[model samples]
Every structure is written in C-alpha cells, then in structure tokens.
Target chain A: MAVCPDFSIPAPFFYVNTFYDILYQSEDAKRIFGEHANFFSLIDVESRRKFQRLAERRFEPQKFELLLNTVQSPAMLFDIHLKWNRDNHCSILCIEQSQRYQQITEVLTRFTQRLGMTNYDLLRRKEELERLLANLQQSNAQNDRLVELGRIAASIAHEIRNPLTSIRGLVQLLAPNLTSSAKLSYIDIIISEINRVNSIITEFLKTAKPAPPLKEAIPVTDLFAELELLCHSESLLQGIELVILPVDPSLMIYADRLQMKQVLLNMLHNAMEAISDLPNSRTGMIQFEAERFGRYVQIRIEDNGVGMDEQTRTHLFSPFFTTKNSGTGLGLSTCYHIVELHGGTIDVESTPGHGTVFRIYLPTVDKKPELS
Target chain B: MNATHNNRFFQASLDLTDSIRMKIIQFAHILLSGDERKSWEFIEQQLVNGIHSTEIFCTYIPLAMTYIGELWIENAISVVDEHIASCVCDYLIMRYQAQYITPPDQQNCQAVVACVDGDPHELGAKLAVLLLNRHGLQTHYLGVHCPLHHFLAFISKWRPSIVALSVTQSHHLKKVQDYLEALQGLPYQPEIIVGGRLIHHLSYTSSKGAPNKQRLFFMQNLHELAGWLEQDYLPIKPE
Candidate 1:
C-alpha cells in the first residue's frame, strides 16, 4: 500500500551485532569503509572510549558524533545513529557532522576575540571613569567646604565690619587730638591698617554674597586703559612685563564696570604674586587681551609665572581655598561670582612649570544703553 | 507642550529634525559600544558648538538612554551592553556636573532635588538639578539612595522653598507618599514636585489630577519641568 523511499543514497546504513561486529554493509558503507568486517576496525582509537560511553546509556535509538576511518582517510568524523532490533542487533546510519562542528568552532573563536577587544575597551573606560569620579568627589568636597565657609563668613564679616567701623571712627576722632609728631605717625599708621582690614572684610563679604551687577555698556579699550593705569606702579615695582594687546575701541560689553575692573585688578595682583614666587632669573610677563567672538567678548589674561599644580587648580576658585600662607583666597572666588552675575563664564588653564591663562567670556554689547 | 516652549526646550546648534534623530542614533551606538572617549568628545563638540546644556543632558542623553533601554528589552543588545552604557552615561553626567559652574546663588528660592529613599536611579534628578541651577534656582542635590531620616534632617535644616523628588519605578511611589506625609508635619510646608519614570505610570495621577491636597506638581519630563519653572518660578525670581 505504501512505497518505501530509498535512504541509501543520502547516508551509509549497515547492520551490526551487539558487540559492534559488522554483519552487513550497504554499498555506500563499503565505499566509505572498504570491506571492513567489523565496525570496531573502522573506529579510531579515541572514538572507542566515546562508543563505550554511548553503550552504557539506554539501548534506544540515539545519535552521536564519533571518529571513523574511511577508505581513503585515517580518521574522519561522522554522525553515528544507532537503533537496537529485537534480535539484539544494531542498525547504524552514518552522516558527516565534523565540517559543521568546525564552522561553529570558527564562529565561536571570532566571537571570543571580539569580546576580548571590547573587554579591553571597558577596562580602559573604567580606569578613566575612576579618575573622573575621584576628581569629582574632591571637587564636591571642596564645594561643600566653601559653602560652609561662605555661610560663616557672611555673619562673621557682619560682626567684624561693625566693630571695624567703630574703631575707625574712634581713631579718626582722636587723630586731631594727637599733636605730637610721633603720636600723629602712630595714629596715621593705625588708621591705614584699619582701612586695610576693612577692605579685606569687604572682599570677604563679596565672596560670601555677591551683589547683582549694575549693568552698563562700557568700551573694552576704556577698561584696558584704566587697568594699565591702576597696575602701572605694581608692575614697575615688581619689574614684570605687562602687555595689553590693542583692542578695537568700538567693542563693548554690558557689565558692571566697577566689578569688572575689580576682577581684572584682582587677577593682576595674583599674577604679580605668582611671578614673585619664582626666582629672579626668569622674566615674568603678563599679557591681557580682549576680543569679540560670536555673541561674546572674550577677555584673556595670561601670566608667565610660577604656575599652579593640579591640586591648587582644582580648588582655585573656592571661597576659602588658598595656596598662599597669607592669602584669604576670596579674590578669585569673588571674580568668579562677578563674571557669573554678568551671565558670563571663566576658565583657567595652568601647568606646574609653565604658566597660567585665565579666559573670561561675557556677552557682547554692540551699542551702549541710554541712561535713564 | 506649546510649540514655542518645545522649541525652547530643544534649542540647540542643530535643528531637532532628522539631524537630532541621527545624533541620537549615533550617540546610542557610541554609548552601547562602550566608547567612553568618543562619547565625551561628542558631548564636548556639541557643547562647544552652542548646543544648550539642557538640550544635551535633558533631551539628547535621555533619548539615547531610552533607545539603549529599548534595544536591551528587544534583545538587540546584551545586558552587559546596557550596563556599560549606563556606566558611561553616569560618568559623563558626573563629569559635566563637576565642570559646571553654577551661576551665583542670588535667588532666594532654594530647591532641594533628591531621589526617593530607596530609588537608585539618579540621572534624572541630577539633570533636573542642573537645569534648575541653570535657570538660577539654588538647588541642593542629594544624590541616589538618600535615606528617609537623613533627607528629613537635611530638609529641616535647609528649609528649601521647593522639594523636588524623583523616582524611577512604581514600587518607589509608596515611599514617596511616605515622604509627602512626613513633609506635611514640618513647620513650613514646601511645594513638592515629583518627577522621573514613575510619574509616567498610569496610576500615579488620575484624570482629576494629583491626589494630594498639598502644593504638589507631577512633571512628566524635563520640558514640563522647564515650562513650569518658566511660568510660575522664573517670573517671580529676582535677577
């Protein structure tokens, strides 16, 4: 009723005894194994152990991969399918599976190599991330400290300013009463010292709570002229070269002129101090430049002086962070606040042995605002 | 969102047409491939080229991360790839925060941004803080896994005008409710703004709006947050 499909053309099939002794071989098997009387002779030595393990399992039909010697080769891999008959004989079918296995192994090896490449990339990124995290943690800790200091300094400055004002007033009131020359000099010195302390407190308060800028459109050249006039004596005394690159007189910025000048003067003072830190052999130079870039006016101040290390640079703008023994460290922080108040940004780059450059970017004003 | 506000939200050097979508795809690839260096370079170039920080952090980064998440869900990317992308994103955010200089805290309206007590996802909260700070709010960011007691103590000490809480999943909502209940007992009640992925859940709010009677706002995204600030907070804030 049913037609039997010929399966001999696809694979070699044979019958074997329970001992794996070949009873009959198909034409395909004969061509493959070449007149082998027993299946044991066609099996490789390494495959004998695999065959033994396979025999220990249930005697139901199963498929396995084993190395079998062919007529023209010493050993070849094939898929061995075995089914047990009621007479204790086994019918076997053989199909090649080694080429597929080799292909899979090749794919796996390539995949492993790709994985290794990305693993290396991940490791590199991990190290970079660690460094970034450490730097961030340090910066955050410093910020916390500065915030606490600002809170304390605001109240302390208030208390100190009141007393300072009374002392100055009392001393000024007593100044005329001291007629003796020696006493007059002492009074003069006391007044000036009080004024200095008052100025320091003022700067400290500015860092704690900065006043909003009184915006006005001022010419860059005018600011540059005032700066040169203000710093002429100090640069001459320190014998440091102060170069102001020429700026177009038309270029202007809407900012608080007083606060802007204060920022420049403070930075120039720091540049002078940095220059003083180095030996007399090196010629200290400070270069200032202002230019219009896009919608912003960039102010650059560079100094050839004893530059800061990364540690100092990291906390350079913190309210109370200072590298100098006598420094209050409010100068740069106040400058930072002033620039930020003007909707501007400040950036600094310093190398330990080379120098330092500070760049301040402020929105440009094309035309001056009319005064009310 | 209004078209004008949406435009403002995505204000960047490149238009958010096909270009931004392309950028998102490129960014996702860079992140999933674990190319941290390239990711930074890409971000830096964008920042340098006049792309707003909010657009990059709030829009672009979030979009890229969402794509990465979707890929992981679809089995297109391995779990390891997702983790690597998350790590890279975290590092970039931290690095950006570290480098960012918040404008002087002249605003009297102080805000406290924190994740829920048990929630570990903080990128959204961090971005919120950065955006709020950029908009001139004095924001204190209490990062991931902030315990209830410690957060309460900080809230008491700081007495912020607004408390912005973030949660990543629906499971964290109960904890957020607990936070709201505890905050109600304080001497001064601060307006609360709840945000993050949990808010997008269908049950977080009803058609009638937020369940709480207190001054609470549920923001859907950074765009909504920005719009809210522009409408209510920025108008009142003194320069």
Candidate 2:
C-alpha cells in the first residue's frame, strides 16, 4: 500500500478530517475511495450539487456518504458527517470506519439497504422470465396446432390424390383424339377441377405453416370490384343484397393480391351465407367498405345477418371452430392468417340479436416494414 | 377366466398352453363370419389387456391362415370359402395394424416391403410390412407384382433403408435379378432383401455367381428381421 506520509497509521481503522479544502484521511479511507482521490472528490455529481445547495442554508449540516473506491479492495464501509462551523468559516466532513463497524445498528442499516436493492433486481428478473415463458408456451401451442392441421391435410390429400391421379391418367388417354371445341371444353373443365383440388391442398399447407406474403401495393377500390363481380351471382341466388361502399378510392395496402382476394371473397361469402341462414333474413344486406385510419387501411364486411353467440365469437378465429352446420370452419381462420402474414389483425364486433361487423386492418403500403 | 364371465376375450389368458391358440382360432373364424359386434369385443379386450400385437400377427393369424389353406387342400372348403377367409383375415390384420400402439418417438429405419415383378403372393409381404412397421421402422407394403417403374418410383420417393422383395414361386426368380439391376442403377442405393418360397433355390446373396443371383436377404420370418434390426438399426437410447 502506498502510504500518505503525513497521515499514516498502524491500526486497521479509518478517519477523515476536512480543513482549508485539503482532506487528511487515514490509509484505510484512501483504500476505500470509490474513484476520486479524496473525500470531496469521492462525492458523485448529484450529491455534490445537493451539498452545494444545502451549504447555502444557515446551521444546515448535510449528512451524505463519500463512497469508497471498492475496485481494488474487499470488506469496505463508509461514514461521512458534514457540519457547518460558523466561527471557522469552513465545512468539516469526517469519515470514521474500521475493518468492522463497532455498532450493530450501523451494520443492520447497511444490510437492509443492500437487501432492498437486491430484492428489486430479483423481482425485475422474475417478471422478465415469466413473460418469456408465456411467449414460449403460446408459440408451442401454435406449433402443435399446425402439426395437427398438417396431419389431417396429409390424410385428406392421400385419399383425394389417388382418384385424382386415376382421372388425370384417363384424361391423358383422351387428349390424343380430341379435335372438337365441345370436347376441348370438357377437357378445360377437368383441368380446372384439377387446379381447384391443387389450390385446396395449397390452402391446407398454408394453414399448416405460416409463410411470408408475396406482397405488392393493392388498391382497395380494385379489390372491391373483384369481390363484387365474384359474389354478385351468389348474392342474387341467395336473395342477399351485396353492397360495395368504397370510402377511399386511393387507399392501398401491402399484401398478396390473390391472398387478399381470397380473404375478402371468403368473408363476403360468409356474410351472404349468414344473411341467408336467418329465418327472417330475406331482406338481408351485406355491405363492404374500405377506410383508412392512421397507418392502416381498415376493410369492413358488415352483415345485418344472424350474428354469432358469445361462445362462437370467442372461438371465431380458431381453426376448425364453425357455427354453420356444413361449414369447413376455415373461412375466418384463413382470413385471420393472411392478415397476420401481412403484419395486420382481424377484429370482429357482434352480438347475438343484432349483426356482425368483421373489420380487417392491413397496414398501408408506405407503413409496411421491409421484409427481411 | 371364469366360465360365468360371458366375455370370450380373456378366455385366451385362461390357459397357459394350446388354449390361447384355440381361442385365437375361434376369434379369427368369428371375424371371417362378419359378426363385427361379437368379434370386436373379444379383439378389443385382448388388445386392451396389453397383449403384444406381434403375438396376433406372428402366431395367431398365420396359424389360422395355414389351417384355411389346409382345408382347401383336403377339399373340405371350396375355393370361394378360401378366398373369403383370406380377404376377411387380411382386412382384420389391416384394422389391427391401424390401431397398434407404437411409441411416439419410435425408431424409424425406413423399409419398402413389396412383391417382385410378376409375383402374385402379397399376404407374406403385407405381414412383413406390418411386422417391420410395428417394430418401429417406417415401412411401405406395396402389394403384389410391383413393376420395375413403380418400384423405382417408390424407392426414389421414400428412399427406404431396405427394399424387401418377396416372390412366392420359383419361376419369378429371374424377375428378382432384373429388379435388382434396376435398383442398383438408381442414384440412392437401398439394400435389397429377397424372400419367399423359392428364396433358397435362387441362392439370393450379395454374390453374382448364381444365374438368378442378386444382392438380397432371406429373413426366414419377422423374428430374424427384428433381430437384425435390433443389432444394427434401433436407436441406442429409449425416447
């Protein structure tokens, strides 16, 4: 240890005296200087500022710790006492300590302060761990659901593909002799049916595992036109009025065009079906509207139809949860999936007696984050 | 089992010897009669009581199948009787295969068990498929006379660890060689396992000196296959 020649002492004790802006402290005090070399310098910025303000008051003595340099030492403690001396025109700050404190009360006070800090740190870590655990559990549940979907899809695909393969093989045999347009249209129908089956398989796979969207800026007005054209015939047949109200002609969202169409068409079909299902829903109206709020474009498919009960509403977004007698239960689930893939959400507001409003929020093109 | 128990399922467990065999034979006959309600009760009971599935596949069904074939030889049952018995037994075997309990993380040494080109005997190959699958290997049983093209396609898609070929007649031994040649030319090589009635006559081995010689195996039964798999393929640790 480098000794301060003027203040060197043999006892393993510490003392500090302040006079004329010069600190005469014991070797043990010097050893415990946290960073600065002396008692006045050892005080942190906020504490020194507080001392400066308190120093202005008459008969006010500030009691603060001059933190020791604990970097190169073990078994440290600090005791700082400041008092204003009216006669001497100076402040006196004393640091009195030892290898161990003489008083049990002082030890207990330090122990209590450390315990409080440790407890707070422990609580913060526990909360963080619990949050992480909850996230992990949710992700695990999602994965298990996806695996189950894949298993079901695999079995269905196997059963369908055998007959499909046989039909396709027979069609190949018929293709060589076809020269007439009427026969050619039959071939076209077969090919289209095959493509539809393929599409169903693709949809199943999408639900089995979520994938990044093949995104582009798609205008809401254009999408509204597509939905109208597709559902117009069905609406007339089912005696449901399908209305398209385009609030923002220029509102665009970043999403897969085909996927967005499927989502809209699926929702519109469900709306029309819901309207038609009601015993007194002959004068049913299904309305489509698009509007922008903040960074998102909100597309609403509202139906004055048979709104769902609370139990159905709670399980509305879950895959394979359906209220309809013959529904496959993938209608809203797929819509929810596509919106999520585009970094958006699907929300519903409905009650049993009234009607249901399905609101889809897709972020505007400019607001969409850059996909990695 | 008590005589007053009324249930025929646990009757197999009543006796230590030939009684279990007799009980199984009676159930097999019951299944063939298409009385599913009566048959299922006994079958489900045996399965639920933790009877090993291999006991049914390896012992009970084979004995009943042989007995039915013997009845036909003695002119006791007609050809139609034999056909119905075989078909019913096959269906029941498949039903049991579907419900057989396997460990979730079971070892999967992928195997393709099928009849060679021009071989009509599928029952043996089907049993082998079930036996391998039940022992925790992913197995595909392609029924009778798997042509070279289909065989190649199955091999390419599954990339099985073993290609188990079965041929019942001696005349189909030459087809085995052609199948081996086709398999050997493929990019991914799966080991060929040849077996059936005429397996010994073909001298099926990895050697080529014999005329119908090919790299093939002759597992006398599922027991031998299980033994080989346990020695080499099974996972070192229980999962």
Candidate 3:
C-alpha cells in the first residue's frame, strides 16, 4: 500500500493490491462502480472467463497508461484496472478518477441528450413525410380519375357530333320535299335524336355539379317497389330473373327524389347488363334489398352475375370502366358521386363468378322536414 | 316416478352426451378437410362449451390437415386451385383474428409481423401471426406491402423484441434489402427474422455480384416457422 509522508494513519486511498477488497467491502467503492460492480464478483466461472476475455481486449496496457496519465486536474483518480498480482488476487488500481470521470460523464450526458432530441426530430420529420406521401397518393389518384373522365367526355362529344351531322344532312336532303306526313316523320326522328343527345349532355354535366338537396319525404318501399316493377318488366323482356326483396318500411332515406331514383336506376341497369348472359341452367340472380342501418338507410343491390376480379372491382366505380357492348360506363360512376355528395358511402363486395353486392348508405331524416 | 326419472333425466343426459361427442367428431372432420366455413361453424357451436377456435385451428387442424392438401395435389389437384383454397383459408383465419375478443396477454413478448414491400401475398404472414399468437406472444400485424419507412417508425416507437418479416415473392428482394439496410441505421433495431416462399427461390451461389449475396436460412413452411419462433425467438428479454 502507498503511504503519505505527513500522516501516520492510512490515507483511505485504495491501492492496486487491496482494490478488490475495497470494491467488494465498501459501499463507497460499489457506488463508483455502478451496476457493473456486482457483476465483477457475482459472475460464474464461465461468465468470468468470457468477461475477462472482453476486458483484456478493451483495456489494453497502452490505453490503461493513457487513461491514467490524461488526468491533469486536481481530483481523485481511480484507475480501475483488472490485473493479476503475485498473490494471484484480483487487483484493481483505484487511483482517483473522479474529476476526469465527471468531465467525461458530462460530455457523454450532453451527447446522449442531443441524440435523444435528434431522434425526436427524426420522428416528427418522418410523420410529416408520411402525411405528405398520403396526400400525394390521393392527388395522383384524383388526377388519374380526371384524365379518364376527359377521355370519356371526348368520346361522348364525338358520338353526339356524328348523330348531329347525320340529322343535319337528313334535314338538308329533305328540304325540297313538301309533304305533311313525311315531314312529320322525319322531324320526329330528328327530335328523338336531339333528345337523346340532350340527355347525354345533361348526364355528363351532372357529374361536375354538386348533388341537388333532398326536398321530399319519399317512401322507401314505394321507391324500391317501382324500381322492382321496372326491373321485372325489363327482366321479362330480356329473359332474366329480377328479384327485389321486401323493402323495410321504416327505412326512409332523406335524399333528392329524382337524384336518388337516378342513382337506383343506374345501379339496376348495371345489374341487368351484368346478368344479361348465362346458360339457362346457370342463369344469374339479381337481388335488391333495403335495410335500416344506424342513422342511415342502406340499399343493397346484389347480382349473381359474372362477378369482377380484384383489379376490375378496384376501378369498378371509376368513370368509364365498362364491359358493356353499347352503354356508357358513367352509370355507376355517377351513382357513386351522387351517393358521396349526399353524405353517403358506396361499398362493393364481389367474388369472380360467384356474385357482387353493392351496398349504398344514405343518411336518414330523423327531424321534422324543412319547408323548401 | 321411477319410469319418469329414467325417461326424462337419464335418457336426456345420455342423448346430450352423444350429441356433443358427435358434434366434436364432425368438427374434427371439417377441420381436417380445411373447410373454412364448416370450421367456423364448428367453432361457433363449441363456443357454448368454452372451446377456443385458436386452439383448434393452431393445434388440431394443422397437425391433421397439413399433409391432406399435399396428397390431393399429388393426386391431380391443380396448383392454381390449391392457391384458391389457401386464399380462402387465409381469409377465414384473418376473419377469426378480426372477431377475436379475448385480449392477448401483454406480459408476454410482443412482436411485429409484416410482409416486406411488394410481397402482396399475406396468407403466410397471417398464418405466422396466428401461430405466434397461439403461443401466447402478442403480435401486431402490418399487412402486405407495408412501406419500409412506416415500419421503421413503428419499430422505433414500439420497440418490439422481434420483427418477423415475410417475403412471399422473389420480386420483393430489393425492397427487403432496403428495409434491412434502413433497420441497421435505426436507434432501436430489433432482432430480425425472415421467411416465406421467396426465401426458397433464393440460391446459395457463392459467386461475386450475384443477387444472392448472403445465405438466408429459409423456413420451408408455416410449421417450420412456428418451430423456429417457439424454440429460438420466444421469451425475448428486453435490453
């Protein structure tokens, strides 16, 4: 043990030889070692061997000398070195490392705090990035939809122009003829074509306009019953089964009567097209059922027609995705928009060749009807 | 009184026991057949008796039905048809997960199971979650094609013990590598374990510049995965 010249008693400093005794026996020594102090004494034989190997690699002789000599400040330096002595006792050089250790601890604490702040900043930035990404994706989807709408509009315009040109030519060709019946017939044909063109234009324009507000308390059963009659008549003509389940009388949707009817008609037309073809034995079933959901009236139109695959189902409500031979794909797309405008959502569930179910939810009127 | 007792009480009890036994046998057969709807129905019926679907599906069904489909496939069942069956079974399993009301024990080790980006087949990942959950591990399932950055953010915040990644298709190799590289840079990186069909597609060629740079220990199927999880990955102690 090292001794001070001025004192007759021991200096209370732990020397290299008595270091293990001090670390194991003294609470003050254990406090300096932290949680690792117990590990030094309590480790089993195999663990001690492994730890010794690691310690040897980490605490080399040159690094030990540097650690001891680097303390220039007037503070207790505890150079804790695990070494073997002549007596084969575990020796730890307990020089006063307090001042240098405090400096290192302060530097490390600051670094760790800065690291934590950086991590928090990174997290905030990541959240912002995710939000931006989600927005970008939504915008891209909208852009794609707009482009598809534009294409459909161009084709529709071209179709209308061709018919208009034909009507114009027919009018010009029949200009010289002067007969009452013949003129009336030609005028009737022209008027019908003009009406068709007008209807097409009106439907296309409706897509851009906000849905008209609900003005009337229309009976849900009556509306669905009328739809059922129409579907049944169409089915009779086309040799297909059109089934409408009994509508729930309590399920009244607060919606514009004309707009809601239009939505239902479009869905019914789509269903008719879907099931138009089948061998008589494997003919598809079309069903329309109404049920009252919480705060909303749900109308489900299900078809056992050739149901769509995932890819088709994903874009099923997108404007102008049609498998029809001579029909505008705008039908269901318009229905979807109108439903959305009325504070409602449309969901479709389908399995290929199994069936499709289109569920439309609309808010129900619970309060007294407002006079318009 | 003796005749009444024999007719009403003793006979009714015997009938009830016979019905219960019969139902259980039928349920076992349906499970062995891999009929999802029938299995669900059986599970619902057994609910009154307090039998859990998770226990039946994870233990009994997999043990008996694992090789049933293989035999059928060998005897001329189409591969595409097998995929459809797998899809149905996976869907049912997910439905059960959705409907499961009993809260998983939070005291157990928690894990995040996800499919690497571009690997859209989620059946394998779903199966892994079911098996892990059966073993009493809490699992947070992030479905197929989960973006890498989102996963990293979740990992940092949640700090789960294990991150189980599934890559079903070979096309997701680049994305998986990118995910691993990103994980290496994270502050709270968990122990990463990967499996699925894509691993089988990877070769062990030692040539430089080849796509297969490292030998990923591939798990053949869900059984292998369950074994690996139970033996090597469970009971993770927090650092």
Highest-scoring model, lDDT:
1
Model 1: per-residue lDDT, tens digit, A1-372? 223234455468777777778877788888878887778888875456457656443568877666687877545668778877667777789986667757754654574355434544455678789998897788678778878987887788889888888999999999888876558866866786677577667766776355566789999998898788667878988899999999989899998877788899899999988899998879999999999989999999999888999899998888767888877677899899889888999999998777899999999987856574
Query: Candidate 1 regions off by >4 Å?
Result: A1-372, B1-16, B103-109, B202-214, B234-239
TM-score of 2: 0.33
Give the top-scoring candidate (TM-score): 1
Please state the error at residue A42 of candidate 2 in Å: 99
**What total of clashing residue pairs does each candidate reach?**
0, 6, 8
Provide TM-scores for the models.
0.36, 0.33, 0.30
Model 2's alpha-carbon lDDT is 0.64
Please provide, for model 3 over A71-129, each residue's C-alpha lDDT reduced to its tens digit, 9 standing for 90 to 100.
Answer: 22211233344544444334343445456656654654574355334433354467679
Provide DockQ values for all models, in the order shown: 0.01, 0.00, 0.01
In the range A1-372, model 2's lDDT, one tens digit per residue, is 323333445322322333324334455544544334344454432234333433343566555433233444322234444454444333333453543344543544464355334433354467679887896687678668877887987888868867887887788779767855458756755775576576666665565355566788878887887677667888888878888885666688888877888888888878777777788735899998988878899888899888888889999988666777766577788789878888899999997756899999999965344664
TM-score of chain A of each: 0.46, 0.46, 0.45
Please identify model 3 stretches exceeding 4 Å from their true place. Answer: A1-215, A323-329, A370-372, B1-239
Inter-residue clash pairs, candidate 2: A32-A68, A32-A69, A33-A68, A33-A69, A34-A68, A34-A69
Give me the iRMSD of candidate 1, please: 18.8
Q: For model 3 chain B, where is the 10-residue window of minimal lDDT?
A: B1-10
lDDT score at residue B227, model 2, on the 0-100 scale = 64
Instruction: Order the numbered candidates by DockQ, best leading.
Output: 3, 1, 2
Pick the winner on lDDT between candidates 1 and 3: 1
